[model samples]
Target: MGITHRGTTRRVRAALSAAVVICAVTAAVPAAATAAANATDAVRGPTVAVGGLDVGVERISVATDEGYGAASITPDGRSVVFRSLKDVAGSGGNEVYVHDRSAGRTRTEPIVEGWTPAISGDGRQVAATTPAQGMSTQRIRQHSLDLGILPFGCGRCNEPSLSADGRHLAFGVVDYISHNRRVLVADRDGGYQTIAYLGSGAPARPSISGDGRHVAYQDRAYQKEGVYLWDRTTGTTSGPLEGPDTYASLVQLSDDGGKVVYLSGSDTYVHDVASGTTQRVPDVKGVAIDPTGRHLLYAPHGTGGPSLVLRDLRTGTDKTVSDQPATAEVDSVSADGRDVVFQSAADGIVPGDTNGKPDVFVRRLF
Candidate 1:
């Protein structure tokens, strides 16, 4: 269900302007305990080998102050933006912040008191959800660092994805009465149009192809939700992937528009648009194919908790890039797909419960 309510307002503080100090402490494990925990995790399941590479783990970033919420990266993989709450125990209102790797600096801006920020494919625009004053008036707002705020009207819009050209946007909009959500598309200039409706059922996440002619989304109107594709040029939709289980999430299109990747239940699968063939790429809860279309990075599901997993699609090789137990959920990948950033908890340095306070973390793909 969508978050549909209004309440008190809260302020967000900025991260320290001083240099980022990386301590030697282990994020997921202490040095002495690493060997024993690694052995246990390995025995939980057979280690699948892809491209002669075994999974390795490391910690990239950890939250120190206010909790970070949703995070997104720029196309070039040099910048990241996320939401942060001021007081860990207060109402937890959110504000957007950006981290620039090239400049080695972090900046905070009050974009909106919202969550689920989606950076445009061109890295110029951002679409996010904001709670309305009333229960039935939630809206989605688009912001551009260069152009300021763009006027657009939307109710209960969330999980937004932008096309490669940055001319169009796709998002899930909930219909209040029916309690059903549909995938909708709109021009960057604010022209609203329906893309696909799932009747009484909620439409799954929607992603647009590189050329902006096709869109891939999940639908559950028939039975359980399954990945589906829509040809924008032809104005037709098709799918109901051949599988027993029928739940899917995190739909994403390849940079070249040749393939679609989605989470089918707990496993990640890729489908060839032309051949209609499906294959698995080691199960991961979050998956993204780089803009070059050569590598795939994901957060593999595990009883040891979530960890970032990188896979080379061509070589069929995968590795665990983050050693820390995955703290925050990954939101989006850069257009070039070299870096993955997420929202995590700030525990030790921040003087608050890590689980209650969130922060942003990022890792560069090697």
Candidate 2:
């Protein structure tokens, strides 16, 4: 399951300007640690050699804590934003971090005790779950494209997912009296919230499009249990496109929200929203799709072991991206289908990964 709710008593530093916070945090990190984090020799060349296999992979997270997850990458693959509990000097708790591949630097965001961060395609805006001021309720916070920190007033909202342009934010909010959790899409600048799903049971986390027009979610209600797509243009909800079995989960929509990739039982399938056709992708576990919805990143099963695979939907071709057969799982994929990020417990993915904990790694498909 995704990060549903995270309430913290840590301080919220929303008053500080983004420039001052960034400069202060960047200067606080020790030079030696910064150098060690950016020493990504395994990710520069065409192919990274791992146990005699060629795979261009680099482990990005160097945190000592083992709770790193919910990663998002820019469309250009230049920056990666994720939530980390790494202990920074004089900092309180977990915070959001952005790792720039070109600049070879990682810096913390201004949010305090943030969780489940999602970045926009341009790598400018970021949204995450943070504590409400003076309250234990978890609220959504956004570092908008204009460099201003914005907060949503929903006292019980979490698991924020953003559109590629960062203009729309999708998340789950719970009603206080009815105790029902529904998916909501809100405008970043318009101060409007639209309910995407309002049925009985709890809906799955929503996946939005670049223009915030389409939202894909799964309904857990017994009568209408399947994946669904909500279109804001028509102001209507499409369907619970029947899965193979009763259990269906892990729904992910492309940047255009025209296609959806999800898991049913042990198999993976991609559903075209317009045609209402579902195709079961054999020998792979589909996780995410690129902006165009043509390239899919999955983990092929029935092979030797689990490894990252990038499959082109149009050509029916597959490229194995992970070099070693460790405990790796695909997370997010870049827009151009060239960069992929994942997490694994195995070592040797990069040099100096001696923390003995699961770490996030990026693979370039070039």
Candidate 3:
């Protein structure tokens, strides 16, 4: 494994530009103390360790002209699903692929011919947007990427997300009519369940928790766009993540769906579903929550350039994973927060990483 050091300092100032709002409690979460007015403006920079944290770096895909990106590592850390462009001459498209670590470097296997691929925690099931076969024009269709897929209205679906157990899948649907957009979740064997319907606003991305009982999604059906949690047992949707005039974009949820991390304007917050308190995470971009809900992996934004960051929710300690300061766009992370996968064009993170092209790299924190 290669280890490098970044010499940049972390900086965060109070007074963010986004509108601030009080946290709202809903459903099971009890109301905690509210943040004082302008308190959201009083954010502090993340604490950084000297010399950065040493991490093991490994290249998962072999270099190719067809391109391999948008990768997702299983929670158990044994398998990864990624997007691969086809190298067929005169073709200008891509598909989703699965790479089994046990298979060595035998090249990734194409699981489905689609875009935006997501896999179940065990890596046994995959979901994606495949081109509808036999359609008059090129259209997108949702599928298990294997067999037993059903049809939906308007003939379109994308941004598919799977549950930890691989039993449930949540995705967005775009209908041909107005305000008819919807967010739906379906079981691999069961039919589709309409969780939230948007009559006025467009449908946002939908995600299911590890247990497949709760779903977090953006709802435009409300007067204002808000992040909402749909309860499966009651078949009702409630508990919109409250935020400033700046609508909160829920990015990640804890394994049990008891916590949520979202971005309000440029500021990010972590909301505890059990306590209903929102904790502001200063200067963190593209935030993600670990399955334990005790750790967070994020991209730190600053003039020092983008660095892979890990923040301990319990201890408040921040560790830098990449010593080399380069522009890194975070792609996806594992459930434990130990496996962080990101795209970077920098040369210092690992030696011989001279691929020059935007390549995908995984940093194993453990």
The predicted structure with the larger TM-score, 1 or 2, is: 2
Off by over 4 Å in 3: 1-55, 64-66, 85-92, 105-115, 133-154, 200-203, 323-331
Q: Which pairs of residues collide in model 1?
A: 50-317, 57-323, 58-322, 58-323, 67-358, 68-358, 68-359
In terms of lDDT, the best-performing candidate is 2
Candidate 1, residue 126: lDDT: 58
Ranking by TM-score: 2, 3, 1
Question: Residue by residue across 1-366, what tens digits does model 1's lDDT show?
Answer: 110112111222212221211111111223342221112110111233446632221122223444555666656776566666653233234555555555454444435645567665555455666665566455666654434455555557766666655677777878888888877666644354576667654546677765666667777665635666666665666665534365666457765666777776667777676766666765565456665555666776666743666677768777554555443332355555456665444343222334555545555444
lDDT of each: 0.55, 0.64, 0.57
Where does candidate 3 clash, by residue pair? Answer: 5-323, 6-323
| Model 1 lDDT, full chain set | 0.55
Where is model 1 more than 4 Å wrong at Cα?
A: 1-63, 85-93, 135-137, 201-203, 222-224, 304-306, 327-331, 335-337, 346-357
lDDT of 3 at 277: 72
Pitting candidate 1 against candidate 3, the one with the higher lDDT is 3
**2 or 3, which is superior by lDDT?**
2
Q: TM-score, each model?
A: 0.71, 0.77, 0.74
- Residue-wise lDDT of candidate 3 within 143-212, one digit each (tens)? 3322323343335666677787666667776665563667777665535676766665464767678888
Runs in model 2 lying further than 4 Å from the true structure: 1-55, 62-67, 85-93, 112-115, 132-136, 144-148, 197-203, 301-303, 323-331
Query: What local lDDT does model 1 show for residue 97?
Result: 53
RMSD of each: 14.1, 8.9, 15.8
